[model samples]
Target: MDETVKTPVRSFDIHDILKCLPHRYPFLLVDRIIEAHGDQSCIGIKNVTMNEPQFMGHFPGHPVMPGVLLIEGMAQTAGAFCIQAQERAPDAPPPLIYFMTIDKAKFRKPVVPGDRVEFHIERTNRRRNMWWFKGRALVDGQCVCEAEFSAMLVDTPTA
Candidate 1:
């Protein structure tokens, strides 16, 4: 009998994103991670659509992807980065990524339905359990949003 073993991928699809991050459904902003270089940086993708819950109320007729959600997407991307950066056993529990800080956030363009947003994140600094990253959300090679953010990786708590 011959069997093929699928090598574990460092880059993430939606399923892998689900496994790495705790978010789901309307909350899971990142659709896929197209690129990741060790723990240094990554690029996450989000396919925006009219069905997203936020579109219902953000503006009745004009649907603009919220800036906060863009930040959230970037944070989720960072979460995946934190997971990929660490060396963990196959059965090891996944760590929870927590937002520490956000600075220098600016929205230069509006992201709307049908826009495929690419979030590019680069690690700026790492100390102890926290990591600082610079992120930019782009559509069609134009910057939509940019921010500097930090997050901490923590072991899941036991009850």
Candidate 2:
């Protein structure tokens, strides 16, 4: 007999993310996540705007999104994956994911103002505390950046 299986999709609003990550506005590259599957994968959103500080001098006449921000966005998505994965386990406090390696990073195109950058990441492997992920960022369905990175899961200590 075949059993029907469904992997529930979890959503995280800005408030939920704030609790998971120690980042604030102007630095919080990821806005929200529409779908999350613990340590497997996730889809995230980032609203870009001209009001961002880097736009001031990133280009005198033209404002271009920085590559570092793109990587940060991916990192945020990976962080979300780790956080959701831990919550799905038996019972646990908050988990803090830290970037261990960021490799094969490439910037293919320019992400400008008024653009909504979407990020998709999948966990390739998770051993003990380290997690490996392959991620890509897209704007208007066009790839803007892509990379493979690894991070460590460090649970926050409870009092």
Candidate 3:
């Protein structure tokens, strides 16, 4: 009998997101996943707020979401996709997704507190344990940031 079991694709709430990725408060960026396609794409939501640590120094009094964090949020969305993919095989080892490279990054507008950022990420390529994705962050349907990035899925190192 086969020991491997494939995990299915599904939506994620904050609790679910926590289970899929290893990030926590202050660094955990994604608020929830609205939809996801098997190893293909994911759409996630982020609720920005003035209380977020970055805003305290990123530019006090004029809170703006850092471009890097926007990219990070996009990356997190991709990470969730990878986690869901691994679920497809129950016996498959849980993999840690690492940001490998980022390119073609563009920030079109400043993201401010109270903005609901939507990260739209789609797989571009996958070779072995490495995967490439194109991502975009939008607010009110307007693009605020976009980039192409790659990540590697590997077995978590023993402590």
Q: For residues 1-159, what per-residue lDDT tens digits would candidate 2 score against the true structure?
A: 769766788989988788788778878899999888756889899999999998999986899999999999999977975776674455555677788999999999999999999899999998988999999999999999999999888868777
Q: Could you give candidate 3's per-residue lDDT for residues 1-159 as a string of tens digits?
A: 988765455788998777678899989999999888778888999999989999889898899999999999999999986787765466544678899999999999999999999999999999998999999999999999999999998777777
Lowest summed lDDT over 10 consecutive residues: which window, candidate 1? 1-10
lDDT of candidate model 2 versus the reference: 0.87
What overall lDDT goes with each candidate model?
0.90, 0.87, 0.90
lDDT digits (tens) for residues 90-141 of candidate 1? 7777889999999999999999999999999999999988999999999999
User: How accurate locally is residue 29 in candidate 1, as Cα lDDT from 0 to 100?
Assistant: 95
What residue pairs are clashing in model 1? Answer: none
Tell me the TM-score of each prediction against the true structure: 0.92, 0.90, 0.89
Output the better candidate (2/3) by TM-score.
Answer: 2
Instruction: Report the number of the highest-TM-score candidate.
Output: 1
Q: Mark the 10 consecutive residues where model 2 has the least summed lDDT.
A: 85-94
What's the true lDDT of residue 120 in model 1?
96
Clashing pairs in 2: none
Scored by lDDT, model 1 comes in at 0.90
